[model samples]
Each structure stands twice: as C-alpha cells, then as structure tokens.
Target: MMEPIPGESKKRVRAKPATKREMSQFHTDEYVDFLHRITPENAHQFSKEQSKYNVGDDCPIFDGLFEYCSISAGGSMEGAARLSRDKCDIAVNWAGGLHHAKKAEASGFCYVNDIVLGILELLRYHQRVLYIDIDVHHGDGVEEAFYTTDRVMTASFHKYGEFFPGTGEVRDNGIGKGKGYAVNVPLRDGITDENYRSIFQPVMTRIIDFYQPGAIVLQCGADSLSGDRLGSFNLSMRGHAACVQFIKSFNLPLLLLGGGGYTVKSVSRTWAYETGLAAGVELRGGKLLLAVWPKLTIGHAQ
Candidate 1:
C-alpha cells in the first residue's frame, strides 16, 4: 500500500498529524476521545463500546488506531489549507477522503470524516465549496454533514439500494436552504467508460454551472475501477483517470482525495495514473523507472 508518486517537478509538502482540537471541527468530542483512548491494553473492554460508534467488523480497533486516524485526517486538512491559502491550485491527499464517518460514529471502514473536516477548512476562506464523491458506496456521512447548508453542495455517484451503507438516492436532495444542492446519481452494476462518461460529464457540467463553487473537493475512489474487490463498476485505469481529467479542466482550487479501493494492485495503479494526470504528465508511453508491482516508485522519467 504505497502512495502515489508525484512527478519530479512537483514540490512535495509533508502533512502534519491532526490534533484532537483540529479534528473536533467535524467529529464529536466523545467520538474523538474514543479514538484517542482505545489501546491494545484496553481494547478488550472497548469492544463493548464498539457498536455505539459502528466500530466492529468494518472499523476494527487496531493498535495505533488514533495515529492512523490523525494522519489520514491531517492530509486532507493540509490539502484544504493549501488550497485556501492559494498556495496551490490543486492539492492531492491520497490518504484522505474517508466520507463514511459521521459526526459521532464510524462506518464503512472510516473512523473519521476527513472530507468533512477538509471542507470546513475550505469554508474558512471560500464562500462556497463543492464536494463530489465517486466511491462505489454512497457518501452518506458527507452528504448528511452538509445537508442543510447552502454554502456546501454535495454530489455523490454510487450504486443504489443493494450497496453497503445504502443511502444516496436521486430523490434525496437537500433540505431547507440546501434544497436542490445535494445531487445523487445512483448507478447500476457493470457500468463502463462510455456509460459513465455519458452521465458524469453532463451532471458535472450542470453542477458547476449551477453551484459555481469557489473550491472543489473530489473523492476519487479507486474501488469504482474494474476488478475492485468491493466494487461493481467496470472502469479501466484510463476510464477512472478520465474523471480526474474532467475535473482538472475546471481549473478551480481543487483538493483531490483517496477513497475506497480494496483491491491493492488496482488502487495503486489507479492512483498513480491519476497522480500523473494531476501533475500534467503523460505516463502512457513512458517507461517504468522503478518497478514495485502493486506500488509506485518516486522518481523522474524521461
């Protein structure tokens, strides 16, 4: 599980771990406390508390759980900060996009809703922020977090009813001031490049026209790619990167984040390809400077 390698010309910014106070921007104090207190020594007793926060099979309590959550959430926060400060036109956080964690609960292998926290950071500078989730499962937590806020518009494209944590429906648009802002494009199984584009392009165009957000956060979940262990879509590397390409065309302040992808090899390849796309590099005909199989190597290619 190596991260995507940035091009040699790109300046890499190291992310700092998110502190408890920083994470409290979106996560509840109690939930954050649980993540900090759970340890191998007290883990057996904590099992009884797991169900309260949806931390069982999907989100098991492992050692260094707090550190993992802090680092993952930290990357998204750093990306958002960079975008808000105009430090970078686009910031990529391959460790983030955990859209399934709620304000006080965990779900779908996500323990902290880093995307929400990241959006909050962007909101500090931008009047409006757009969150687009391309995970196979619905971005229920993120959609819910901004459901009543007009300043943040959330759009999720995912599999409908039969999927895990099923929630996204085309009819479930936002409420109150957020009405007409929450968009859902639920798809069937076996979606290919052409069909996905036919739907993605038009919907995204309409969203951009209507919302005109000052900043955009995209959750590029590799699980949607073909042969993903937990996904049903049939997208190839090119097909998956096409989504990133389309979004990058907007030329707005953008934050790219990683999401669901159980198949190790596919996830690494998809992210690496998309990273090249973000860096304005054409990796198609280039030779592999270093071979790591499931992971990518960081280096320059002629």
Candidate 2:
C-alpha cells in the first residue's frame, strides 16, 4: 500500500508537558500531588494512597508515571488550543484519549482524563464541543465529567453488558442542563461496518444539526476493530476509518484522539489509516481504501 509522507501532508509538533495548574483544572489537588510524589520505588510506602487513587492492578505505580500523565494530557490540551486559536482545521493526538481517568482516581489504565482536559480547553473558545467515542468500552469517565453541563455533548458507541468500567447505557442521558446531550449507542458483539454506520450517520447528523458545536473531539479507539485482543466488535479497518471520514466531512475544527486498543499491529495500522483520512491523503493499493466508503457532506454548522 502507498502511504502518505508525513512532512508533505501533515506536520508533527512536540507538545510541552502539562503543568500542575493545568491538570488541576479537572483533577483534585490531593490526587495530582499523589500522582506526582508516588513512584515504583516508593509505591509500597503509599499503600493508602494507591488504594485511594485506584492505582494498583491496571494502573500500577511505575517510573515516570507523572511524566506520562502530563505528556498525554499536554498533547491533548495543545490540540484543543490549536483548534481554539484557528491554527489548524484538524489536530490528531494519538496519546491523549485516556478517557477512563477521574477527578480523584484512575481506572482502566488511564491516570489522567486527557479527553476531559481537551474538551475543557476547547470550551474556552467554543460555545459547544461534541465528543465522539468509538472505543469498544464505554467512555464512562468523560461522560460523567460533562454529565451536568450542555457546553459539551458526549456520544459513545461501545459494548455495554458486563464490559470493563461498564456504564454507558442508552437511558443514561445527561442530567439537568445536559439532558439528552449525552448519547450512548450500546452495541453487541460482532457488529459490522454497515450496521455501525447505519446507526452512526443518522444519529450524528441529528446531533450536529441540533447541537451545532463549534469543535469536535473524536476518540478513534482501535479496539473497536476486529481482532482486538480485548474487544468483541467485528469492525474492520475500513469500517473504523469510515467513521473518521464521515466526521471529517462536517469540516468542523476536529481533534482526533486514541483510546483503548490491545492488539498492537492492528492498532498501529488503524491509527495510521485514520491519520491519513484526517490529513486528506488517499491511501492507495488496498481494495479497502478504494472508495468503498462514501464521502458524506452533511449540512454546515449554523
């Protein structure tokens, strides 16, 4: 397959690590300090702290733990900043979709909720921001963060029953001002591309029409694709990229983020292909990339 050259089509920029003040925007002070102070060398010392912050099994106390969290959150916030300043039409941060982190605790291998931080940054300039998650597991932390506000709307398509961090039910729409703002499409095992798009297109069309968001944050998790070690969906690479194509057709300020994907090879290929789609590069040489997916043109935002 012919691949697009990175420099010709897209530019890569290094993101500065997020500062304590910046991460404190969503995380509590105690939690942030706990993350900063604890390391693998001294993990046993902070037994109470570990349990308090849910950092044991999936989220272990490792070396450079705080640095990793800062970098991830920083990249996502920088992307949001670029969109807010009109510096780029679309920004892709593959390291910043750790959506399972909470204000005071970590879950599902995520120690910082970078998706929430990115949305918070976009909310500074945008009247409304729409977050779309295509990960196999529900984006529980992100939805909970914005569950009380209408400034951001979260739509997640994921496997629901007995899944890890199980939360995104169809009925669990947002509360108070955010009512009907949170959209969750619970799927079963082995959902195909056609079936996924059939629901994705119309639902997103209505969402864009009604919400008219100024910017969009899309979590393009590769685990939704077939052959994921931890996922049950049967979506192929083409099927997954189709979501990105449809969203890009809207022509809004877009921030693309990476989420959960256990299969390394599939994850790499999927992210690279989705990155090509975001950069408007036609990846040739595969029947999958041969225009089987339609280029949709939904109505412009008002």
Candidate 3:
C-alpha cells in the first residue's frame, strides 16, 4: 500500500472538476458529449458507440466514468494552476497523465487527455512548456495534440513497433512550424538503468538547451520498472527515482503526473519513492515515519 508524504501539511489543495467548456479547450465537443452520456446502465446499450471512442475492454465503461475523467483532469488543471500562480515550485498530480487519450477518441486506457489539458493551462502563464514522458508506452495523444504548435515541445521514451498504439516513430518530428519540437526515443524490451540513463540524460539535456522552456511537465509512469505486468523494461525503484531527481535539478515550475503503471505493488512503491523525493524527504532504510497512519510500517522484508 502507498502512504502519504511524511512532512506534508494537513491543509488540502482542493481541485474542481473540469467543466465541458474547459475540457473542450483541447477535446472535441462530440467526444466530450459522449463521455458525459456514458453510465453503467446505458453502457451496454452504447457498446457500438463506445467502440467508436475506443472505450471497450482496455477502456471499459464503469460507474462514475465521466466523474472519474473529470476529477482526473481536474487534478492536472489544479497542478497547472498552482504552478502558474507560483504557489509552489513543483506541483504533482499523481492521478493525471492519461496521455494516450485523443481529441475525439479514447485509446490505451485513457479518456480525457489530462496531460494536454494541463499543458494548455501552463501555456497561459508560460510562453513555452516542455512535456517529457517516461511511460512504457508512447505518449501518442499528447504529441498529436501539439504536433503543429511550437509553444509546447513533447519528448517520449517508450517501447515501439507492433506495440499497442504503434504511433511514435524516431522520425515523427513535429510538422510545419512545430518541426524539430517533437522528440521520440523508441526503446526495445529489457532496457536496464545504465542504458536508459545513458540515453535519457544526454537527450533531455539537449532538449533543455534548445527548447529553453519556461515550465516542465513530467509523466513518471512506473510500468517501466522490473516485474511489471504490462511493461518490458528492467528499471529498479532507485533508477526510476533518479529520473525525477535529474528533472528536479532544472528548478523550473514543474507539474508531475502519473501514467501507465499496471503492477500494483511496483507502482505504489515507485510513486511513493518519487513523492518522497519531490517533498525533499530522504527515506532511509528501516521503519517509515508517517503522520496519517500510525499502524503502517515501511521496511525491507527480512
């Protein structure tokens, strides 16, 4: 089970659900309407239509589906708002990062494209934003959303070829004025920490040097960790946290979001570790110190 940040205050940052108008900023009206119309009772009736939006099996329709999407998008928008107002140097919405949702259709277990919504929010205050995806799968929806814009640069590192969505290519740079703004580093299975860092560090440094973005959005998907159900990489908890450490070094207004992690245990551990890192807390070996729950103890199994 995941625990709360150790030193975090009791004051909660409330986020309002994104209205249809707000969601329509980056999504199509028809698509937004379809999401609203979905309900558990009527889900079966609309199976044919749901399939049109890629909402089946992988993207199943359940109770409160619309509300879930709205809340997820709301968390991302809240993070963006906090960054824009300078309330915090780094805001994290671990609930967001549904990066594969398209403008008019859902795909790859994503529905609202909250990353796009968050980036749009950030663009209001910053002239340029940098989006970095470390998920096991390509961030196809986000890349497509800003493919023609130069204001936001998207970079993704994921498994390519014959994969689920199969979109991101090494040469699929941005189009028109947005050329060279999109960067893709497609990887194969069983990628270890050293190899991943060898490529990640240099590529990210180069993008930072060239883009000079005012703000940054990072998707820390834990599926790339070893022993994941749907991922193929061999990253460990420490290795995954190192990526967060490197990005935090930039010291820009940053929004951290969650993405495609399927293994429950690994995802919880990875996010908790990253959260501790973001909160500037050093987690040493032994029992954890949590304020929210006293019964929980964190340590290595003997």
Candidate 4:
C-alpha cells in the first residue's frame, strides 16, 4: 500500500550493455564457450538434455555469449540505477529478460536473470517493487528468486501448465510472507494480440493499483510477436509496445526489460521499435535517427 515516487530517466536512449568475460560471477569461461560450440547441426550429437540447454535445436548459442550475456546484465543493472536516479519517466533495460537462466545453469537460451538482477539493484533503495512479465514463457527465474520476499511482487502472464522448464503453476504463488505477491496469470495457447491486450491491461491495473509499489519492472518479450520461430502467439511489435506505453502511462519509476524473442528479424525490429514508445519519442523507422529500441537488452540485450 505504498505510493510510488517516480524516478527520472536519463532522457536518452542508451545503447545495449557490454559483456566482459572477466566480470561475471555466475558462469565459468569454459562452459560459456561450450554453449557456443554445441549448437544446431552438432547439437544433435550432444546428450538430449545438453541439446535442451544448448543452442542447436531451439536456442542457438551464438559467438557473443560472453559479450551479449554480460552486456545484457549490464543494461539491466543500469536500468535499475536509472530508475533510482530519476532521469526520466521510465528506465528500460530490455536486454535483461532472460527468464530461463538458473542459479548455476543456463536453460531455455538464457544465460542470466538480468531482470531479477536489475530489480535486486533497485531493491537496494526501495522496499516495494512490482515485476510484470508478459512473455510467452513463464518468468520462472525471476519469479523463483522473489517467491519468498514480499519486498518484490512478480506478475507473469505466460502459457499454461507444463511449458518449458515445467514450472510456474497457478498455485505457485508466493510463499511465507510473500503470499499473493507472486501472481501467475497463466495464459492459453496461441493467444493473439487482442487477447494479450484484454488480459494484460486489467490484470496489470488491478495489481499495480492494489500493491502500489514504488517502482515497476516490465519484461516485454518480443517472442510474443507473430512469426517468431519459437513463439505461438500472433502479436505485432506495435501491439507489443502498447504494454510499454501502458506501464509508462502510470508515470512511475519503471524499467522496461526484454526477454524471449526468437525470430531475428521480428525480434530485433520489435524491441527497437518499442524502445521508441518507452522514451515518448516518435520512431521514424528507417527514416529518422530517433528510432528507439525495445525489450531485447536481456533477450537480445545487445
């Protein structure tokens, strides 16, 4: 029941994070390169579970695992700092929505929980934080980290029972004092943008209005965008960015993070386009120099 004191954004659309292999505390250098090598064609040669975690079958491990992963974490951390410093209405770290990364393992293509890390940085100052994830997959990593803390509220709207990682059941709400703080709105399969909007707005309004946290962190994954190889939904980037606009409309200290997003073409385009929306600038799209990017900092977090 706390009122939010909105912080300032930097008033600039900063570039993505920089990943340095030397700085990470979570992963080992050998495994980082291992993830990159066992991808796609050679992926089939790996153990089934290894292929599950590697890049070949679905989540392709790329050359920049060290670079991209570190940079993504950096962006999310910066977003948390931006909100605390209060440079603009919203601070976005789209590269930090890597929900699949575990405490010591990488699964579902994610190397780190940038969103959780960003929120943790924010928690250094504020007592209440609201995390809203609108990705196709459940925000398992973020939700798990905050599942026992009332200080943060994680609201994820993702596919129903038995998705990847095989967690996030509706009954999996918060535990101990964190009860009801972890709200899971498991969505149906193959939902369109309209369905997304309908369910998203009301639930978000209800939760944010009731909890009244000091800040909001949104995971607006572009995997919800149509034609994504891994995604089942049919949303356009324009439709997806509407979520960013909605959160910003609250005028709170917000960090717009990114996650999911498989199709290279649509994924990059969608997040970049949404970044324009969060900044309150008109995106000229291949014409103007002011085209902002969206929620890939964690997912694309580059």
Candidate 5:
C-alpha cells in the first residue's frame, strides 16, 4: 500500500536482519540460541525445550520463525538508530513493536521484543526515552524491563481486567529511583473517541511535560479501534490516528511502532493512515469509517 508513498523510494532503506549478538542485548543467550536452532521439523526432538520456553500454543514453532523475529527486531533497531543520529525526525516500523516477549520467554504470540531493543538503542544517545503503548493488552514485558530505571519512562493505555498478559494496573508504578516513571491507564470496554481523548490528551500532556524525554517510542496498536476482533475498545480510525497526530505535535524524534491489531482491513487502514500522519500527510478526509467484519481475521500479526 505504501509502495507509491510520496518520496518513499528516497526515504526508505532495507532493514538488515538483526544479528544474534544484537538480539542478545536484551534476550537470553539460551533463548536466542533456541530460537536460532529450533524448527518445525525438529519439534519432536525438543519437546522439553519448547515447554520450557513457553512455545506451544500461542508462540508456536515454525519455519523461518527466527528469521522473522530477527527482521522485525532489525527494522525497529534501525529506526531507533536513525532517530538517535538525527537522520530522521520520525521513523516508522510497522513490522516491529512486539512488546510481550520477555528476556527468556515468548508470550502472546510475540517471540522477540523489538520495542525493548529499540529503546535500549535510543538510551545510548538520548538522556531519557518515553515509551507509550496504546495496545489493548498490557505491554508487560517492556514495563518489566525498565521498571527499575528512570532513564526510560513507560506509559501504557490498555484494557485492564482479565486481558492476556495482564500487568498494567494503575497502581503498579515504578520503584526506587524510577518511582512514578511508569504510568498505566487501565480502561474498560467500548470507550468512544471523545471519551478516550478526555483522558489520553491530558495524561499524555502531563507525562511529556514532566518526563521531558529526548525521544518517544509510540506503540500505535490498531486493535484499540472499534471493530478489532481481539479488542473491545470503540475507537475509530480518526480516534486512533488522533493519538499519532497529538504525539507528532510534540516535535520530538519519534519511533512509531505497530502492536496488536487482528482485523485485517482496519489494521491496514489504520497503519497506512498513521504512516501518513508520520510523514506529515493527511491520507483521509473529514469522516472516518467504522464497520466490524466478523469473517475477516488475521491471526496476531501485530
């Protein structure tokens, strides 16, 4: 869809696959080795290894699984590198933002956490980095990784109760020197555009003002849209993109990432629209579309 994006030929660069050493920055050596070694054909030989790494149903073993994880991580790491070097004001990586993968285990269909690697890259050059997650599920792995550090502040707005990988509670603030750095906005079902803005805008404003981050990493998960099969929020395309526009208004070096979005059409439209927003282009008109497709479903690509 972005093939003919204005000036994309000049702006885009092929993301190199992340090396095992690069992935090792945040992943355990045993886990990375297992990811690099295990394959579908050898599944019977590694039953214990699979069970140990939590790789059965949700995070299944497949061909090119390691390569897929590597490429995704590569795209995000490259985006962060570009931003840190001041080569681009905003870098968008729709292939990245797997926030559920821990250091040694996969969760919620995410095998590797590119968000953490990208943040670690940013922290090298920036004094402070702010991570904002708008996914329906909590970004638990990311919050856990930086929970003890004040250098990176994580703010998440997610569906709270009885969700997968549930950990983003409002009271689960950071500890020690990082106290009050982590912000979680646990929300209910079927929240509208106006209602979301009332909370999102003010909260983001306060966070930005207080944190004063050198860079921002935003996980624009389209599952928060109204018709998402795996999500319960009532936000429209405009409602979701509104978050992008507001964040862009900050004029900070931003790394835009993709997270959970199951509805195929909505996910495509939302990311394409948000990409346009990142490029300072308005890809849509005044009104936004809202229609739930019960039949169309893409399994956890985000």
Candidate 6:
C-alpha cells in the first residue's frame, strides 16, 4: 500500500461523520458568558507570561476562539457530569482536552481546560477524581490547576527535558496533601506502543482502581500518535485507544479528554476513531482514512 505524504493536504479527507453530544453545564451562566466574551484580541487581558500563562504562537488567539473553546470546556465538564449522574461508564470528548489553558490565561494550544473543569464538576459528587494524561506534551495547566488539591489525582506521562512548558519532572510530585497525587513519568524518546500499553494501562488500572476513584478523566492526546509532527512518542491510535478501552473495561466512570494533537491528519483521525470506539458509535461507509505512519518498528513485531 502506498502511504500518502505526512501533513500533505488531506482536506479531501472525510472524517467518519462523528457528532458531539450535548455537554452538561457545570459552570455558572456568568462564567460561561465570561468565557464567551474572550476573543483573540481581548484574550490578551488574561495574560501571565512570566510564569505559566501567555498568548504564544501555537495558542495564537483567533476569531471564534471563545466559541470553540467554550464548547470544548463544556463538553468535558459534561463528561464529568455523566459520571456524577452515573449515566455512562465512559465519556470521551475528542475535541475537549484543552489542558494548557490556565484559570486566567491561555497557553499551549489550550484556550480552556476541559479536564480541570470536568474534574471540578466531578468533585461536587465524587470524593476523588483521577486525571490521567498521556499526551507526549506535559499536561502542565491541568497539573498546576489541581496541584495542591487532594480531590484530584493528576498523573501525567509526557515528554520532558527541554520539552514545551518544561514542567512535570519526575520529582515535582505534588505539594501538601496532594503529595504523591501528581505523578509524572517524563519518558525518554524511542518509546513505542507496546511499552506504553504495558506500563500505562497496568499502572493506571492499579492506582486508580486501588484508589477507588469515583470517576476518571483521561486525556488522550493524539500528538502521541505515531508520525506526529510535534510529539515524540510513537504510539498508534489503536494503542492509545486501548488505554481508553482499558479504563472503560474497569467499569469505572471514565471521562476521556483530548489533550494535544498537532499533526492535523494523524491527530484528527486518531481522535475520531478513538472517540467512535469509546462512544460505541458504529462508523459505517466512512472514507478510507489514510495511515501515513510507517509500519511499526521497535518490537511491534511481538
């Protein structure tokens, strides 16, 4: 099979007509309205560049920034609401993992943090909420937002060592009661899907299950998707989706989040496929999505 060039124009690509469910409203109408007011221009008013907030290139403010971001934030929070209402065993939002948005600033590509909002909403009902981020990029904003809070356990498996945001060293752990709650596994390069599956699922299952978290929010960033333009990890969409399935199989009320995905083709389609898998929405007659990722190497043979 001939592989199409990576990042080449695939606008002709047709995603499997996936539709978004209605997100629950956790934030007050006032807060939601406040978010709607932020535009690319006014977004600068909430700047915090010196340490952990700013309007950088990747997160450049643009028109409709608030509109899309509000929906993203609301959807993930809605997933948490499902867990709270015990409506679904697992809720995944492919468009709602804006992890970098700070309380008052926008950073990384995240204009609003759906994970944080979801966790906050979940906390109202559940005693403990566990957040697991598997983006190749560090889930800095989410970690910081919940750093000192014991209600949420934010565990991140991301690339560190001069990586973007440069937070989440193996040591930062957590502060106060949140100690040991924030676990960071800053993995090195050359990591593959099997290695991730072996480590991520088992560890998460053990910790979350043992902790007996009332709910779980998983950030499945497709930047970790193989052939990624920015992400360093070489995980396949199947492999990443396996983590989602793992959470679902555990019978825990899971809320899936989309954290980071730069390579548009790989990120968009991977999220689409995984979202369909989690939602159990059978995609019929979908166009043949291209897989430009080189056939797996590095022990995928096993």
Better of 2 and 3 by TM-score: 2
**What is the lDDT, from 0 to 100, of the residue 165 in candidate 5?**
80
By lDDT, is 1 or 3 better? Answer: 1
Candidate 3 per-residue lDDT over residues 206-240, each given as its tens digit: 99999999999999988889889999999998888
- Tens digit of per-residue lDDT, candidate 6, span 74-131: 5666566655886556665666777876766667877666777778888889999888
- Reference-based TM-score, model 3: 0.91
- 1-302 in candidate 4: lDDT tens per residue? 11222223223444345343422434455555555455445655666646544544445555555566667777777767756866444665655788877654576878666776778778887889999988888888888878888999999888786667677778989999899999988777678878889988998999989998988888887877778777677788778888888887887788887788878888778777776666544567475343333321212231
Name model 4 segments beyond 4 Å from true: 1-64, 284-302
TM-score of 4: 0.77
TM-score per model over all chains = 0.92, 0.92, 0.91, 0.77, 0.92, 0.76
> What's the lDDT for residue 126 in model 6?
91
lDDT of 1 by residue, 1-302 (tens): 22345443355666778999999998889889999998878877877677788887878888889998998888888888877886677788888889999998989999998899999999999999999999898999999999998999999999876788878889999999999889999999999999999999999999999999999999998899989999999988898889999998898888899999999998988888887777776676664443222211221111
Question: lDDT (0-100) at residue 137 of candidate 3?
Answer: 93
Local distance difference test scores for all models: 0.85, 0.87, 0.84, 0.71, 0.86, 0.68
What lDDT score goes with residue 234 in model 1?
A: 95
Highest lDDT scorer: 2
**Residue 100 lDDT in candidate 1:** 93
Write down the lDDT that model 3 would get.
0.84
Clashes of 4: 29
Deviation of model 2 at 100, angstroms: 0.6
Candidate 1 total steric clashes: 0
